[model samples]
Target: MIRTGNEYREGLKDGREIWMDGEKVTDVTTHPAFKPIVDVRARMYDMQHDPAYKERMTYRDNNKTNPVLYKLPHEQKDWADKLEAVDAVMNDIGGVVTRVGDETIGEMWSLCDGRDVLASIDDRFSDNIDRHIQAVTDNDIFHVSANTDPKGDRSLSPRDRDPDMMVHVTRETDAGIVIRGAKFETAAAYADQAFLKPTVGAWADEELSDYAVGCIVKMGAPGVKHICRSGFAGKSRAADYPLSNKFDEVEALVVFDDVLIPWEDVFFYRHTKAAQYVRSSLHRYSAFPYVLRLLYVADMMIGTALWNARQTGLDKLQAVREKIADLVCYREGINAHLTASIAAAQRSPGGLLMPHQSMLYAGRVFAVSQLQNMMHIARELCGGQICITPNADSFEADGSGEWLNKFYSLNQRWQADDRRKLLAFARDLLNSDYAGHRLTFVQFAQAPHFSHLAAVYQSFDFEGPLDFVRKSAGLSDQVKG
Candidate 1:
């Protein structure tokens, strides 16, 4: 039942309404702007089928009625194994852009009923969770999540927004609920089945009932429309270069036009107090996945930056080595945290595996805080070489071809064109508009992350440590008079 890459590509050709720049995309898979994105996703699908990666990336499970899993496991090891597969594929591609690899997206949606983190909230969603897993094991569908709704103003609540600004449930019926408004900055929607959640938490007084309304619909369902974002890599002629080709410039705003979500699909409804818990749960499960991802990105950046430094002969300087050292620390710290989280994973009563919330949050907080430093260190170390490197087109151009090649080259071992390509990629990572957007994303996801750490600390009994301190100080455990 393992689908071929072409089968996956053909699967996406199904009718969907996506709008970009005042025009409706007739076909998502065939559109010029979207074709490359599809091609990239297809490559991920191909990876699952590739003889080398097939065993790791795809799996077969007894839970699966159909044997779609390339490598099947009935237990949590299957989940972890699949995660490893996702990490390997993502690492191989440069993690920053391939944020929603086919496997990553598929796995993201694989737990719609909150089996991952929402397991504690309600046992009812477990069936929903199993259904999704079985279908994924059967169809091998791709999915992406939309966690951020366009708040319009951070200071205001969802209800305070022009109702159309935030994705909110508008009406409730016995059959299903209708959602209005839009989700912003969604990654790779064109290639996805549906966005998972625009979160039912952070509710305003009026938006309370709307909060529990999370569900999935086919892309281009009755009211769904995709609004495209400008991309840094796809438009540039230098996109043919190594990193750019794999980079994800595919993003869109998901505007819901009174979309109907069935009751069966709704996981959490109006549990205002549990809102934070639900959001926290999603982050809990996601922490390692992203850490697994960032570690890969850091590796790519370090290697690419180092190569650029050496190619330009700037690697000889003590200061440059120091910068490289700092970058390496960033990479190492995240990996260490990733390892810690895995070692600390907890088991649920129902036999589901759950990651340690405290460690997971800590790992993400570390990643979010240090990513800027990693990028800055790379930029400062690389110096003007990153920005000044001529575009790939310039190397192939008749006008300045000879001048660029001669001037950009350093030693005979590295060609000028080769150096240009490396520097160009570094430049895109550091200086481009999309690069800034990515940084902003990291900042947002990281901000207030420490709150969860504090919550975990508060929830756990530290009386053992307190008793130790008291005993060491010879203080009495007796009550005060």
Candidate 2:
């Protein structure tokens, strides 16, 4: 069931409407803004077929081999296997790229856990959930998520304002339902499909609402328009901004102009309870991979700072070593949460093993909330040269090249070209425009700061603290009731 690199590329030529930088992109696989990221995704597929990586990236089920990333988790070992697969891919690609596939598939698993709640509304909806989960594994599909809607005028209700502000079921047909609205999706332009759902709102009190609907959306279907943001690739030489050139995952505002959702694809409709269930439990499994990406990011920061210190002989100072230790603490703090969550994993309502909810959510908050300060520390260690240093061309020019060589060359071990290359890399990672965008992505991509705190608030076991204080202070027994 594993697909090859070319097969994955050929699937994107299905006449999907995509626009970027005031012009239409004819082919996403070849477009300058999207081609580098597309190739990174394609290389992941190709790795599954390579002899050296085949055993690590895929698993055998019966007689057929399937991607380990897409396999449904049943035991603790299954999660360990998935973590290993992600490590192999990130190391091979040389950079981190979320929303490729593994990070979004767990959104479906979250739906599977709520089948009983969905069945109470309609049994057919529960059946639909089971079928879609299998389809992704069988077809080797690339799936993404659609949750944030463009809600206009917070003071006015969706019905009072523009009803099209949120995705809603406009009308029901014998074959399916028609939907109208827009959603902000990260990788919808090149993804095969998206699990479209309602955004966060006051849906718990409502019994029935058009905005409370969830279903599967085909990316290439009619009436779906992908209006993408300007990309960072091809705007500058790759020698200066390597991460932006290869790892920019373009976000898009997808306009669903009365798109059709067939009956088989509909998981829930016109039900507020289902919507609330999905909103609360959306990242049950997905947050693991989302937070895991920050671990690699921390490593990048630590590596950049340490290499710069070694180049300038600043590592010999005690104060410099303390700063490096601070960076190490941030990195290990994230590592501790992830490892403990797996060690104390829990079983889901659907009989699947999930990372311990409180530990995972706490890890997400720690990793995302402190990213800015961590980047600042690394930037300080790298020095001001990262921002003022000349590009590669300046170092190769005739007149300026001689002066640049004399100033940049630190020692025989640290030559001019190597110093320039390191500075360029540190610039892109910590000081470039792309760096700011990445910081924002880590903060708000999963949700905002308040939402991360909310997850921790809801998942933590408050009763443990309450009981300890009550016993220590010798409070009344009636408080227990």
Candidate 3:
């Protein structure tokens, strides 16, 4: 059941309680600051109904009557096709869908349902899995995952920190529960309905059960407030920074003031151990694809960096070519690793999980190692041009127009104004608040951080290689014989 982009936009009009700049956001769908983002999300929703995209964006379910398209890799080629379909849609534009809504949250939910984290709750989560999956697919929502707790102080546990710093269940009832506290660095708070999770890292003990509460609530629900970071809220003109204008990935802090969540929407309650289960689902299913997305991003950066170099006549220079090659190496390394992750994937009895340790480790290892390389390439290729380029407004101005043109033009292939625009865009990509988002993806894309990488690498059966080495060394019979 795919919704049209118009339907998707109209759907956001539902009044949700949201706050920015200490004021209420009365209408997210139509608000100047939020409208374009809603439109972008709507475009994602509309993809399913598009004749060209329908087959790829949606798939037939096991019931074979309904269709599903999600991030979970399938053993069958068609299922694999489904993964590619979803990736192709989101990965373009670097997966920076302005506001994180269904696409992002649904992927995490898919992870949870696929891994049986939510299913373990008396099959309650499993029952709604299909329905929830359908709802998100139809809507094409972007999910903003909020997993990090405001630790208050680095030394304290969540309980030791200001309890208000951690999102927790302050009250519970038969109907549901009320959660109080804040989730920081939420990438798409205004766009998503109901925050998902076990609320960061909670233990299994009864004392921590309140923190285990997890459920979905419509955005702008009674007591929820969204506080945006300082920046231009509305769309800026092309004369403004290209990255800032066309594709701002909005990140905000959210406050939940005793927000009520219904029981049906709740996946975990008063079971602290369930938090790990829920997280296991999210990190594996949703987060892994994000790495794949970042790899695509690296590819984009490489191309842009190379083009900027060539535009500057640095393409013929050996030093510049070395930088380009370095970026390509990182790009290819990540792509190859993700390809392996997909190819080696399997569906466990628990659900679809990408536990190919070798692949996961390789993905993470290459992710952080290559990020600096890409950033450096951008720095070397563009140098001062990115920072010093005149804004689009300057070029449009009559007073300095001629001088700007004479100073900024590249070869005759492109005009001076166009070259300046590209430089501004490249600058934003290389350095901006939103650019920090890329680093965030690499740093925290996996929960438990490097531990997950180490676990995957450690769990790999290296014995296969050890045996081969023994055979090559002609010592195979020493132990077996």
Off by over 4 Å in 1: 63-80, 91-98, 101-126, 153-161, 195-208, 239-245, 314-316, 445-465, 473-481
lDDT of 2 by residue, 175-256 (tens): 8999999999998999999999999887866799999999999999999999999999999988999999999999999999
RMSD of each: 4.1, 1.0, 3.9
Candidate whose lDDT is highest: 2
- Cα lDDT for residue 458, model 1? 45
- Candidate 1, 192-307: lDDT as tens digits: 45535545345444434564545656665777778887544456664434444445456688778888877666655554533554454455445556566677768867987788
Candidate structures ordered by lDDT, highest first:
2, 1, 3
The TM-score values for the models, in the order shown, are 0.84, 0.98, 0.85
The CA lDDT of each predicted structure is 0.62, 0.92, 0.62
Cα deviation in Å at residue 264, candidate 2?
Answer: 1.0
TM-score, cand. 1 vs. native: 0.84
Looking at model 1, report the run of 10 residues with the lowest lDDT sum: 65-74
